[model samples]
Target: MATLDLTQENFESTVLENDFVIVDFWAPWCGPCRAFAPIYDQVSENHLDIIFAKVNTEAEQAIAGSFQIRSIPTLMVFREKVIIYSQPGSLPASALEDLIVKVRELDMAQVHKEIAEEQAGHA
Candidate 1:
């Protein structure tokens, strides 16, 4: 799948509707973001099951602010409507591929249980 451009209007709906999503928060002026673009696109082509999306921070300030994106080229992975992983930095193709494998292998039932327990504790 090709990477989809995410905006403030569609970000929430996309996350809610997609089972697995990878979001790349980036800015046009960021050198690292430019370098990572092709790598992200390449990986997206191989993962037809995942929704690979990008948020141009310069254009989508609200979306970036909501996610507390402190740096460009931040990669966030969401599964079952829960954010599973979020990190700042550009990754090599091999590392990105490995991350996708790990995300796919995650036991979401267990993850949800953990989240529920954590929320309960907080409450």
Candidate 2:
């Protein structure tokens, strides 16, 4: 439907609900972040099933730091609460749409399970 503003309060529940998510880590003061807002919104409008979230780095500093977001407009793709893809800077509208499509096609369940097992082994 639309992009959700993710804060520390809701990040855990919303992002870790065993679903796919595309989080845009941004700050209001960043020029590239502003430029990417509409493109990100366009992605949400087109991909109804995907959860599009926005996190204001200025406000969610802890969350941003946890993700090691060094850039203003970083896009992180997650599946089952595990990060799959992360990149800095802004993307074009068409590229954004392609990313959504790619994410939808991935075998995320298997991936997440594998990741979980790997982490468990390490732990």
Candidate 3:
């Protein structure tokens, strides 16, 4: 699957509705972002089951601000409508592939339980 462009208007439908989503926040001016783009696209092609989306920080400032993206090339993974992983960097292709595997293998039932427990504790 090709990488979809994510924006403020479609953020909910694109990321939240999907079971597994990988959102890449980046700006065109950033060298690292450019370097990572092809790797991201290649990975997207390999995983047709996953939604690989990109948010152009320059054009989608509101979306970037909502995520509090302070750095370029921030990668966020969402599963079951919950954010499971968020990091700032241009991951090597190998690392990115590894991340996808880990995300796919996650025990979402346990993750949700842990999240609920943490929220309850906070309350």
Best by TM-score: 1
Candidate 3 backbone collisions, by pair: none
Ranking by lDDT: 1, 3, 2
Ranking by TM-score: 1, 3, 2
Task: Tell me the spans in candidate 3 whose CA falls farther than 4 Å from its real position.
Answer: none
Candidate 3 lDDT tens digits, 1-123: 889998878999987678999999999899999999999999888899999999999999999998999998999999999998999999988899999999999999999999999999999
Comparing 1 with 3 on TM-score, the higher-scoring candidate is 1
Task: List candidate 2 segments past 4 Å from native.
Answer: 120-123
Q: Deviation in angstroms for 109 in model 1? A: 0.2
Q: Cα lDDT for residue 87, model 2?
A: 97
Give TM-scores for every candidate, taking all chains together and pairing residue i with residue i.
Answer: 0.98, 0.89, 0.96
Compared to the true structure, candidate 1 yields what TM-score? 0.98
RMSD of each: 0.7, 1.6, 0.9
Candidate 2 backbone collisions, by pair:
none
